[model samples]
Target: MKYIVFFIGLTVVLLFFFSSCSDSNSDHENKTEPGIQHESMKAKTVGIDFAGHDFFQPVSNSISHIHGIGYPNNQEALFIATHHGLKVYSNGIWYETKEHNHDYMGFQATSEGFYSSGHPEEGSTLLNPLGLLKSEDFGKTIEKVSFYGESDFHHMSASYYTPSIYVVNTVPNSKLGTGLYYSLDGGEVWMQSELEGLPQASAHSLATHPRLAKIVGISTPEGLFLSHNNGNTFSLISEERSIGTFFIKDESILYVTADGEESLLEQSLESDDTKQIPLPTLSEGDSILYLAVNPLHEQEISFGTVAGDVWRTEDYGDSWSNILEKGNVP
Candidate 1:
């Protein structure tokens, strides 16, 4: 598998995209008060604000195992989920968490905070395969949603405005089947999609509409497929083989594709109109892995590559500034 897990650092894409014009569907909200079986959480030795501002010493080593990226704190900070913990990039400086370093898999970032699933670090007492969880106060605390100690949803997506969740289960578990399943009422009930028009080939990437309930974009070796009826059926929208896909707007999407040369494109969902965006050149064999479009400012875009390189374009890709170079703190 080329792109193994979402690690959604965005929509956690917020996997590459996710908000809304309607009332939010986020019913399974976590709280600081004792409510949702947070028996395993232990006070960390480190103080709050792990490697946050006032401690802007640049990391000298290479940053690896980046799960994904997102625009948290209302597009003011960029949070990078990794195998170790969460890394923050703000004001052109990078920082790391002091204690909370759980390998955040299936990470999705929203305006409020983020939703993620993964396992605890080596000595941590949290569940081995942490179930779906959410955090509103940065990485300071977390709230359990569902499937605690039962599942680690690496392939997942959630609507930005509502609590609609989707995942492609790898195996049959006590609560879900081995296929694509989504829940509208939090995680209480899950519905498996028919995926009627999806290609027989394996899906490479997935994206969900930030607002729309039943819209999903599945990328395959064949092309990109759009399902409007909650994966009940699909239609091929693009023929170009894409590596990563992210929804930038309700009717437009940003994606990465490489043939002889790498390319970034923003295509309209309703038609074939696509405008190519300029991307900083990548090293050989390194391509973009994830994208995060600012929900507040659609003109601004950022992306990370397999080599741990992060870049941002403030003028709609007309120009770009390198935030991280091959995971190196520049």
Candidate 2:
């Protein structure tokens, strides 16, 4: 009976040793072989807002310039332009489109569709011309339409009253004719507006008044231009100061950012007169890259800077608060 028990114990030890050796060999093979199992690449989280605090999230890979950002008219989706392609954030999911070789310039949304434009990319060559794209499903997809050859597009504005109509400004390029183009048929075709009173400088931003369909404002390198004839003609409001980003609350009030100043201007659209309103002070410069006014409250406004700081104003630009701090998001 003792001999039988010893033989069984010896058999069990040999079996255990062989199984351990086999498992070790399998792990070693996976480490050495290219097709064997391996850890997956980590995903990138570029930016995050936690409990109202902004944080910088890093990406494992580099990306192209973020030329533009747009939000849908009726949805919470945000569209970002990256060197890789257009990135859409919707319902907590991020999706990237195939690279189209274009530098996304500007974006606008309407009830009928969404509009965007950029410089075209072909192979290794990049064309500074305007290429318009449209999407009906809140940027779930994009389709190229008319190509304004060689002219660089700097600004775009969608008509609030007429959803199917939009306008874009082209910088003077050697290859492409520089000016503005109006698309009345939802980007299927475009016609140049020969507005006699339009300014000659490049238009950088455009906005239409919410209540007045004929009242529009264009921010150019020279100054601000007003159009009362539905973009058919334009006239300079004030040429003494260079206007950067601008927002129109109504036909009576206009908010504009002036060059070389940290304060924003509250001007009357009726008289083109201005009053400088100081913005919130920051350790970094007070330069603002973009300004957005609350759709419901004209007194509430948000301004973003190149240093990644976002400032909010609640009392009609009289006082401001920094909502986002610099170096908090990358």
Candidate 3:
């Protein structure tokens, strides 16, 4: 009887110990294991959390990471490139693209269509890293123009005068990866430019003159450089001003934003004078990350923020309206 009682007690103790161990293991798995959540997140339009949000009608996640912005011709919409996919805000209605939610790295919507390069979406059998892609129907379908698996452009700009012309900063391990590349007949043919006379050795952003065929402005780490004779050579315009992005508003004025400045600076190309355009109503801690001025209407401009917000000004930053709030992308 003593032996039987002792064995029963030992069995109970062992059972209790195993049960506690199992519960601990289960808890750890629940905390660390990604399971379906990780896989679901890979899809741009899957498993999204859209709760208690008044602005977001069909979006699952908040717009946090904005890469680029484009305004295609004949469309009354603004295509915004985000981490998830391309979003369109048209006619006061916000919509997220349904298919081909690939990551668009360098996006520019010209009169022709949308041009970009980046990685493809999850579960896609297409090229992992999309080289140069062109979408004629806005940001709906992408077709390989050139560099199918060769390069990914992070900084791309199109000439306003010529729709097929583009200037891009190429990725490494590609054919045109040495320096600045300029394409007159689209991405079909590329010419590696020497970018002579630039004081700074490196290039950041680039913009072509709206009317001039060969004139282009390049933003470097040091300052802004202007190339009057195509891209064969350049001349430093401003030494003290650190240019982040610049847009050629006609041939007389250049809209510029510095590295850490809040207000927009309008620099006269003829007089070489600078003036500040104030954005007084911007939310606290929100600064301009990107600027887009309408080619047809210079006064109508939109600026995007690093915090996923967008503001528009019809009078060139004098008065502003927050189109997309800081956390609400509608």
Predicted structure with the largest TM-score when compared to the true one? 1
Candidate 1 local lDDT, 104-153, one digit each (tens) = 87777765567787777778766556677777666667778776666766
TM-score of 2: 0.59
Name the 10 consecutive residues with the lowest summed lDDT in model 1. Answer: 16-25
TM-score of each: 0.82, 0.59, 0.75
**Which 10 residues in a row give candidate 2 its minimum summed lDDT?**
1-10
| Model 2 error, position 113 (Å) | 5.8
Q: After superposition, how far is residue 68 of candidate 1 from its true place, in Å?
A: 1.1
In model 2, which residue pairs have backbone atoms overlapping below 3 Å?
Answer: none
Highest-scoring model, lDDT = 1
Q: Give the backbone clash total of model 1.
A: 13
Better of 2 and 3 by lDDT: 3
Q: Model 2 off-target regions past 4 Å?
A: 1-66, 69-71, 75-103, 111-113, 119-130, 148-152, 164-177, 198-204, 210-214, 272-278, 282-286, 296-299, 313-330
- Number of clashes in every candidate structure? 13, 0, 0
For candidate 3, the clash count comes to: 0
Whole-structure CA lDDT of model 3: 0.58
lDDT of 2 by residue, 1-330 (tens): 000000011011111110011110011111221111123223222332212222212223334344444444433334555434454443344445443534555566443445666544455232234345655543333454545333333356665336444444323233223345556555555655555575554344567664565667766556777877666777888754566667666555454545564457777776867787767776645456556554434566665555545566768767876644552322
Under the 3 Å rule for N, CA and C atoms, how many clashes does model 2 have?
0
